[model samples]
Target chain A: MVQASSQVWSQQIIDDIHAKADLGRYRIRGFSTFQKVTHFDDLTFLSTGLTRFPLEGYKEKCSTQVTLGARYASEPLVLETPVYITGMSYGALSVSAKTALGKAASMVGSASCTGDGGMLPAEREASDKLIYQVLPSRYGFNPHHLLEAQAAEIVVGQGAKPGTGGMLMGVKVLDHIAESRDLPSGIDQRSPARHPDWLGPDDLAVKIEQIREATDGRIPVSVKLGACRVTDDVKLAAKAGADIVVVDSMLAGTGASGEALLDHSGIPTVPSIVMAREALRDMGLYGTVSLVASGGIRSGADMAKALALGADACAIGIGALVALNCNRDIPEADFESEVGVSAGQCHHCQTGKCPVGIATQDPELEKRLDSSEGADRVANFLNSMTMEAALLTRSLGKGDVRSLEPEDMVALTIEASAMARIPLVGTNKVFGWD
Target chain B: MVSLDAHSLSARELNQAIKKAALTGSQITILNPQARHNIAVGILDSCKIDIDGSVGYYAASLMDGPEVNIDGNAGWALGENLMSGKIVLTKDAGASVAASMRGGDIVVGGNAGARAGISMKGGTLLIGGNAGFLTGFMMQKGRIVVCGDVGDAVGDSMYEGVIYVGGDIGSLGADAKIIEPSETDLIELWGLLEQSGINDRPRFRKIVSQKKLYHFDNLERLEMSAV
Candidate 1:
């Protein structure tokens, strides 16, 4: 008998091949990348010791508020916290989940995005400030909805699956979702990769102008890019006249995606922020163009690290989903029976049998999650994150979150030192850059 | 009637003025447009607008209910995302004319560039002259009537819509199939052309979705059961 080596071809790789042999195509799954990369965890905060004096962590008024996209728009998006919920489409998520997220954002005085699936009127009513996403699919995109938004995000690409469109199985494409998207029901929907009208950055510039015109120049226009070529893409987007540029790294989550893209595409979140910040600073548009970073922000520490890496604001998806009990074992749901996996191990969002009811459109499963209760939990989570970030800012002797700069942090790992462009701990040498 | 010279006002100022005029339901005329982008955008009211010269990208776009007339040429994405309106263009239009229009009638007297009526949700786009490549590409639910020839890959990957081509076909797009039009479909095409004052009786071929790409080929046991 031949011994199978795990390095050359692991058991999981063999199983993946067997599955593809049976399925005849690339496998689809959900959640963020399974491929481990250097992340925010690799960076460590250097609190006030001898060089700086620490403020009272409990009492210091460390402001977490941030203003985004004040360059061109008459009104910019102001959030009480530096963290906001990222765009997760209604079709990809249950309407109940969308409502809860909107309500939670409103509770925290932060912004919630309308995602790819247009504006849910309920979500609009729930969210005091909403960012309307103009995605490639243009699904359920209405000018009236555009008018209702506080900001507009033109999604050039996303971090989860860059250069490709989104895919939602037929099981989730219910009547209401279908009607809103103008799609025939019960068809596996693959969203178009390119915008219907515009093509390149030049065309994107014109499209931004059109959006500005559509909104009567009231709200800011943001350009969201998947962090594939962060430097060049950021420069082009800023040159294309984006008021805000969002660099969503490969750490981003998705409702459904080809497993290949999840592991193989785009740079990690650490480098994505550093590169995007440098891109803006190179063009002298660093402060003028608000930089929002997303992908794999699991906690307030991650958000703090992102801010330290030069991201003006951070967007969260999987963290918020976890707060909403995504992988939690609820009494009514037998995750093993329904999804053939344990609660914490499940990444079966593509199957539409989400035991927690956050990702599923099934009415019976949807009953498991109460929107109001879910909103409360998410609100609490957002508040806790705010406090933790403020605590860190105060510990660093910074009165405001914006004052938490790269100089306040050091890299724990050599990879992080290079990617974050910060000095390594113990030795004052910056890797790769030095 | 109110006449606003495009030479004097920026696109923002012109649109703001147009909105103000749209409130009172008045006729607005724009002169010397010089192909400036984003002219008369986001006017969501019942009114009439007339442009004397060439307009640029997104001319009369994102409108709900309005009748806009353009005497000269137009740039890209003319009448984009128009909900319910009538856009009559006497000359040529650049790429993506009437893109993503929901409900409206856009009539182009001259030729249209590539991607005309791309991703149209619901509307009727009538073209008197030829249209360029990828016409009716990814059309969801709408009707595109072209009286003359179309360039390569017309009606590519249309989900649920009908494209009536009166002249020669270039090539079909992926998941696009050409089917013989019914008598009613032909009559509808003729009526739309006549409504646009084309006055030409031309036999047309209809293009529709093959639906082959609607669903993925295979799924796992859980996905199969969930569906």
Candidate 2:
């Protein structure tokens, strides 16, 4: 091939953008298609479910607008996209990390959630729409704080370790976190698994009512649940009058807690989405309440896949933290030496002594992170994911991210295929398909 | 003496009296109270409430600013979602005594039921006697102290908080540890006992979680790793 001038190459790149001015309908065939298969012709079905069938007479219809973004289970709270961030506790992350996540989520027009560790003034300052989580640990809970929490979530459970309490190690407990949580500085903070009131569903309803009355019905309330009996729990939550339901998967990120990591319960994200959809449909509350799925969603494709499986959106905790330069700038050898893991296995961030120091509370180590710059990186990553999602939607012949569906995905695991009750890619039969 | 027991008074009427007094600014003293769930639920104003007898569930759920005292035993979630106020139980308390309480002080003279002080965010829970199973199970912030024995699964999934127990702990639940009580814990517990007029602070064994087991599962093999 003949070498082209640098100017010509630049022009070609510009021309590519113009040529595909509407990149929504463009596909990359195998990689972008369901099952990663080349034989598939209907990419939309692979990405989004029947939503891509564009209502009949589309050519005659002038307005064919789809509800773009994630819908909340509660009436008033829906997000603009199917990709969002999960709650990462203040005690688990440094102030800089919390600030960075808040700023980026704000920039992305998505809500950032605060974990049970309590709200950081920095987080509140950086974020506009904050989703305050009320977990088994009622840290940072007060009338004034409740008033400030415009969006509230009752965390019934998380996927990483369902039915388990949480811990903020003394190592991560700085003076500020300690004071906010009213614990001895540098002492372990233990949170119980169950909420004090309402042992089961019936009690849960009463608690929900109490919370609603506490907020004077101004804020939308949702329930965050782990993906265990996802369908049943989702239905229960809907029956309990939840505005939104968050389903966290087993593989979702944990700051530390290697002990918990070694032993805990939570379902994977993919199966959880299907279960949630079924629950919502059974309850006749689909699209009425928002469904946010979380766990191991690393990219826009993963988010798109979840939406297709019937989730309104996906929330990412580990992915966002990782994108915030968590493990950056450190050599593989140094990481291995410091964290006692090889480069590839360095994801054991549960120790809180991050080799890069972004997740640690040690003052000397925390200095390594520049909050503003880290925030920019997170924002950039979110923007990048948005672009990728848009491109995937376009390629799948849909205009919005919701157009993506389980039909666009093929089971990477047989168990996943069974749990999701979806067909395996390149196959005509599902687990019980006749 | 108005023998207005919680059992006789409707949840609405009983609450109405407390609400009216709490609103119009008057002290409401109740005698022989019983099972009056939501007795002073969501009280926003400051008032003195004295219940001479035992009361039912959610005795003062979501209390904002009030002082409630129960002379006898109380039921579950006595101050379930308390935001502010002071609740004192002269006798024992039922399970989940102070679940998801935001801010407040709950002092129980006798033992509390299972899951007492579960998910307490901010507040102080002082139990002069034993505490049943799962005490401070998932408490985020705040302080919980049991002057006597604490039942099994104490501090099961706790994220943040300190638990001081004077007697033997049945078992250390998930993520929970047995540590030396800190100076602050000692001082705080003493102050709370004094504040609640309990006046009995003995050498207590401190049960804490090191935050290593951030999650738990009955299926998975438990790992006792200290990070």
Which candidate number has the best DockQ?
1
Stretches of candidate 2 off by over 4 Å are: A1-75, A188-190, A259-265, A330-337, A340-345, A407-419, B1-57, B69-75, B81-84, B88-93, B99-112, B115-227
lDDT of 1 by residue, A1-434 (tens): 66666577888889999999999998899998999899988999999999889989999788999999999999999999998899999988888999999999999999999887789999999999999999888888889889999999999998999998878888888888889998999788888899988999999999999999988888999999999999999999999999999999999999999999999998999999999999999999999999999999988899998998899999999889999999999898898888887989989887778998999888888999999999999999999988888899999999999988999899999999999999999989999998
TM-score on alpha carbons, each prediction: 0.99, 0.70
Instruction: Highest TM-score: give the candidate number.
Output: 1
**Once model 1 is optimally superposed onto the true structure by TM-score, how far is the C-alpha of residue A229 displaced, in angstroms?**
0.4
In angstroms, the error of model 2 at A272 is 1.5
Q: Cα RMSD to native, each candidate?
A: 1.4, 12.0
| List of chain A TM-scores, every candidate | 0.98, 0.80
Model 1: pairs clashing at backbone N, Cα or C within 3 Å: B102-B122
> Quick one: how many clashes does candidate 2 have?
47
